[model samples]
Target: MQNNKKVIVGISGGVDSSVCALMLKSAGFDVQGVFMKNWTNSAPNIECTTEKDFADAEAVCDQIGIPLHQANFSGDYWDRVFKKFLSDHNEGLTPNPDILCNKEIKFRAFLDYCLEIGADYIATGHYVRVDNSGSSARLLRGIDPTKDQSYFLHQVTGKDLAKSLFPLGELTKEQVRQIAKDNKLITAGKKDSVGICFIGKNKYNDFIANFLGKDPGAILDEEGNELGVHDGLMYFTLGQRQGIGLGGIKGKEQDSWYVAHKDTQSKALTVVQGRDHPLLFSDGCYVEDVQWVNENNQEELNCEVQIRYQSQPVKAQLKKLTNGYKIIFASPQLAVTPGQSAVIYQGDDCLGGSVIKDRISSDFYSWADNRGYNYQVYG
Candidate 1:
């Protein structure tokens, strides 16, 4: 038992965090629950779930016989996370708001609060393991591969890793649910929250349209042929297969038209029909704005690369570029979309990662050769 160690656990009123607080408390640590209030204002007709979450957290704290504190971080969330998300989308890039929230709000502001309250450590329900040894700290993937969240946490620094604790890293989702059930926790049967935090269950397109004006654009097939019109170029992402309305080309032909490119200049969405071999694959990509948790200079490091959260880790050769780094995959990858993050890892340990700037492959530019097709063919 860790006797007399003061630990502050960030409780989101979810089963994972609630279990984390219970685990820490059972271990004899002086664990206090803190619910982070990050959103100040609410959107029209949208219910703010913060009150429910707070009440649930307070119930858990009472059940576990601990004190609960509330920290309001509305200003930081807007200025640091939400604003950057808007700017990144406006500039035609996919941004991960969760990463920014972890970097700026949760770790930075919450850690400050922990220090102010004379806590020795800050804990969360994140499904990532933290290891501190050999003169430094390391972050590793959780035991459950499906529920592992190390990809979104690559931005955490070594300093943050040292003082952080993850109680749910060794458990699977089922195990966490069982723990909550055994303890009769309020969030035992709660459905997992999806999409952006604070925004609740609102559709992504609807949320973006509130800040980013509706600038509809033409959806062009490969060879600059117009297939249909899209709601907005910014709303659609690379390699999107669904939601593009093309008449009569349903079943097989419509399935062929996967988004291959986005022309920001013309505000056009470019797609390729049929199983086009060349345009569907990429060797790897160039990633910029890299951050490393283990090493200061990521000049020489070999690690597995994860292009997206759901993507499997692939073997790659990493080389530091002027701004970031270039990753060459062992096998050809499909739809290495720009605006997504490319997180690198060594075994279970996450080294660092960067945002995807551009894709580099021999077959990526082959679609531009066919220029004879009419832009109004599908219109």
Candidate 2:
């Protein structure tokens, strides 16, 4: 049992965090709950749940008999996260801001704030574990495989992991909910939040349009044939299969269309006939801004990689480059998207990750070159 070591618990007015604080307090640690206000104001038509969320957090703190605190990191979030989100989208790549928030806010800024406030460590509701008994701290996948969030936390370093606690790592979502119910926590019945946190329960395109105005452009097929006019390239992502205003084509109506490429320079969206289209698959991709949670990352290693959160990890080989790393899959993977984190894992321990730059396969290059597209595929 922790002997009254002061720790700050980041409560999000959710069952997971509320349970996190309760479990810590039960363990005899001096626990305090702090609600981080990430998004301060929202555009018109978008619902801002900050006030409601804060009240819920206060209720849970009261129920647990712990003092609650609040921190406004909205300015930090806007400068560090939201701007980058808009920049990536404007460049036709869909970036996950949650990953950025975890790196910059929860673990970086929030951790700093907690440490400055005299807390020994900061805890959160993240569904991942950290093994600090090692030579250096190591991040492990949560016991609950279905709710594991290690993929979204690849940017956190070992130094930060050593000072962090994940109370819900050993518990599944159902187990957490049941524990909350048994304790009569206020958040036990609250629904889990989904999608982008800032734009809660609002139309995605509508929220983005407030920042990035619409720029209508021609949507082209793989063969460079104009198909339709797109609202904007920022609204589409790699492997997107719907909401393209597409209808039954003459003979290809039976086959579904998928976004194969987004040409930001030409302001055109390239689509393909079927999910199995050759353009949608790539042998590997070049990743930039690679971050290694483990201090001693090998120059070359064979490991499993997950390109997106929901996708399963597949066999891959990582080779160090002068600037970044090139990840080659055992087999061609579909929709190797840019601006998405490609997290590396050796067994259940998260090694680290980098943003997918672009496809390095010859097929992708040949297709883009043959179409007279002008974009640097490599440095």
Candidate 3:
């Protein structure tokens, strides 16, 4: 069964990666395990888990009979991903750092390191499949749709994916755990990592505040009535229902409040009544930093778009603009926040994605020149 093909699997102290290494080794391919250290800092009173994660990764490699190599990419992560993330928040935008991490740290930095060390290919535990049948590799969603990670990986090019192997892509979370258990791996029951990689389970706003200091602002309604004050515009995102601190007001306490607008220029936090308020939805939006998996020449193509990671892909059209691309949803979409990504798909293939920049319109979003409405421009 020895193929003599050297593959480096990214072992992250998780059940998925542990099984990935086990399978690669079982298949007789020369396998090695790499533990990439991306984050080294922690918020106040929050325990640093990087040490334990590295130890766990090492243990899993030992169990799988592979040499575990540690590579510290903390500097690369901060410069390439974290700085831009902080900048996006300062501009009142909800940025996704994971996408940047995958593009900059995981695939670029770590992949390069793996190759320099004489690896034939780099593999990971990401729940995504690469179809290399075509001239250009096609990134397909993992069979288990619930665990598919193609959305976050939409920015990665087909070329990088072609050189990558996703062992967990063909297996469900249950099967992965079973394999780990059968092999007696240490990460058999490890909890999945959530939130930002550096922050762990710490309060998001609190952790962010440690980097971006406070900038007090006003909380207003659609009618320009001041309801409350905000610690900073960076603390909240559009459509966020919690942390607004308007739960126990005088008379309007019964009504639900959602973030409708964040104006960094005016230093304002606009809240709208009801979860499904008219001001929350948008018809379309312009996108920047578009990255396509395959070379797509068509300017206008009917496709599906996922505005956020968890949201279902909606019917949309990708229109190439003079300046950039735009996504026109078949129906009004809610909370298509700026700085978030909108991934395009054709059938099961994730074509590409881009960062949302501006919304075309929302029914009542255009008030006077703009302040509160169903339609407003993204920050």
Candidate 4:
């Protein structure tokens, strides 16, 4: 009954992970609960809830009659995940810290620690399934489409996949919550954590300002007309329609405005009139730091790529580059922001993904080509 195999489940003091521990214990595995303390630094306007999470994790472990292990990965997280997150934003790119956390913290640090303690494998409540029937493990989208987390996990290496488990992969959010409720787990009704990894419920603007103070700049229109002033260029991202703080500008329509692009050279945030503005769509994109999962190391292949989590996968042609790959979308993609992951997949198989380095917009391409503008310079 696999009772001899020790499985260390990372308990995050949430319903999903709480239920994950319950399911693993019920399955007769030698289950142990581990609470990863990845963030401990104090920041103004940001609440550090590690103590509360630790207590909840402890209560769950006690209820399950399993020993709970705790480790401080704050140093490793700062070095590997938090630094890169700040660096990406500093470079005017919107980075996904969750992707880095999964790779560096949960899968790398936590996995290594568990293995060192004689655990056969480490599991999380990530809603993604792994297929080990083949010679190499394959990552698949969770059965619950609404909650599938494979996009964030595409950076995980093949070797790590083999030693990982996802007990809630086949269960929906409702099912996991129901299981927790049935077991009377303290986290049965706890809301899922969102926003920055480990820094709970912190406002993005305040968090960024606390770490890296604002570099205020002008908000401009597509034609280079200044509409208003912004706190910083790094504070906004592509496709953002809110927080522009501009209204009733003369000569401009009352329609909603969205962030179309950023001119880092001039320190300007460009705005378009509407959500479907041509500047928001891209025909293709350039990706960097790709990691393949199924050993598909081909130079080029046809696949579907997801630009962000919860987005529908779009058909694309993958052209391998020395450092990354060129993703030419069959159809124009919306809001393909730099530094966010471009996860490639063929059906349900998560081939791999990389950071979106650049994108080719037909509107921008033509506008630049006719004017003989250099793409590199414009980028």
Candidate 5:
């Protein structure tokens, strides 16, 4: 690789990105490390570890003999990612802020910033590969099936994918750590960060309640019988078993409860006793804001769809809609929550994805309506 193009690698102070910087430098490219502070712990009691991460990033850059750059995208994150996350939860939906952060902050804001400083490409530690061998770039699943992240990156355009590099795409977790260890990078054995991106580890409910204030509500059974009281609807999600503050009910076989539905009109949460409750499963979902990485990819066809991260892809039939698309799964999916993304894939290539606006199941919707619980209009 004989090139003098400048590449800005987004280092997250983790083993994957550390190896990214090392590999790019070894490949004879002009490499620099950029730490994007997309979130700050400005809120009372919210922990912010960006400073520590920056220090780790600085250490890796020093070891790699490259310059380190800093950029704070908290403003963009708040407006684009955080606000929508809160809004979705408040409206009885589960939103994946990480997906939005990748599209808005990492690729958009961070990419632009890197380009402004004369970068030819922006790279990250994401476990997804980009195929620029074609006329237009294509996003493919990482060689590591257990860690492929193409689902989260479905919304990124082909143009952006062309200019981005994923140095860790072909390597597994173990390989990444080994490379980092060989190079004596500080993050070689560092534990991976979890929870929301940029937002340090904290109690999820407490963090969310701080923004969407607790609106206490009643927990009801499938028949609308009052079971118990909940702190807030925002704290719950479909198929959630913990934190319900409920116990085994009479004549219910002493089984645990799961959140089946949320009646936003009456501020009532419906619970059922079984883990695989019928109400929790849906045949398909209506999606909005659909974006295709390559427009030439199939618009409507049979493919595999994934509704959440760490979920297994299932066979599905996708049909085009005026505003978006509808995915009809071969089998019912559990907890197909709105506000989360439904990404489409054909074999290993990620076609694209969109936000889940509403889940479609005639039986469930009709049952709720008959019981006087109102769900959003089915698309």
Candidate 6:
């Protein structure tokens, strides 16, 4: 059935991508493997991983009997994803670099390479599915909620969705592993990769220190009282509960500290004692730089909003803002961290998403009152 169809699969030495290639080969498609070289050189603490990844990809291709190609995308990765990551952190936002890497590098650069090579379609190991039956293709969540990567793929356009293929979408992680084991793929037993792809498994604080100099900041309590010291404000993210060395909270006892506020002006990190703290929860969020796949009905609409990758879907009212969109959640969500994504969904289909610029707390008015800031409450 897939005899004459030319398909290019992105093989990242990881099991997911390796299994994607194997599946395409089993489907009888004219499969070719392309290993994307995203980083020019591996950073500190992550040396030779990319090289190892390349070797694994090549091994998979050799075992699958397919021609393999490597494309260098370091320039684009630096200009597009890494630069934005730094900018967001400087502004006190918690940016998801993986999402940007997918949007800018994988789908854009890798797809362009596939097209240049005369491939009919480009496939990846993303857990999300694509439904092209309607007027336009729609990206849907993967069957495994735990492994669903649709949140990171909200930036994919309809056109991109139409030409893209996610072979592992219908299968669960276990199923993918089974397929690899059955086929005796080299990465069959490899552990799943975590954290940012380029940054690898190092401490985020250490990673950021390489690019941006370390600027230690005071860690404060909800009342702005200094409690401890953090390596840097950029190192910590909102909703983070651990790694904070507060003296009073001896050895993970007392109360868990959640990042509540950050002051870029004063370089201060404000934290709350407990997850149930009202100041850490938010009822609404402001998203900026919104992009949609299907531009047919670009008007504001009500849909489900996913603030973070594992967050349960929530009903939200969306209105187009001058720069982006204002999303009001049905209930207060805890730790609505800025610099993360606010992906919108309709049923199982991903609508679109944007970076979170600001958050509105349920007790915002009360918070302002306590802070003595004369802020008006707008409906």
**Best TM-score among the predictions, by candidate number:** 2
Which lDDT tens digits does candidate 1 get at residues 199-286?
6877777777778877778887665656688877778777767666665653335445677777776778887765445676788888
Ranking by TM-score: 2, 5, 4, 3, 6, 1
lDDT of 2 by residue, 306-366 (tens): 9999688999999988888899999988899999989999999999999998876677789
For each candidate, the alpha-carbon lDDT, in order, equals 0.82, 0.90, 0.86, 0.86, 0.87, 0.84
| lDDT, candidate 5, at 54 | 84
Q: Write the per-residue lDDT of candidate 3 for residues 199-235, one digit (tens) a residue.
A: 8877898788888989998899887889889999999
Q: Best-fitting candidate, measured by lDDT?
A: 2
TM-score of 4: 0.96
TM-score of each: 0.93, 0.97, 0.96, 0.96, 0.96, 0.94
TM-score of 6: 0.94
Clashes of 1: 1
Candidate 4, after superposition: displacement of residue 330 in Å? 1.7
Q: Please provide, for model 6 over 236-329, each residue's C-alpha lDDT reduced to its tens digit, 9 standing for 90 to 100.
A: 8878887777656543457777887777767788788778988888888888867786773565688999999888989999887666778899
Residues forming the 10-long window of minimal summed lDDT in candidate 6: 370-379
lDDT of 1 at 239: 72
| Per-candidate clashes, comma-separated | 1, 0, 7, 0, 0, 1
Better of 4 and 5 by lDDT: 5
User: Which pairs of residues have clashing backbones in candidate 3?
Assistant: 362-374, 362-375, 364-373, 364-374, 365-373, 365-374, 365-375
The C-alpha local distance difference test score for the whole of candidate 2 amounts to 0.90
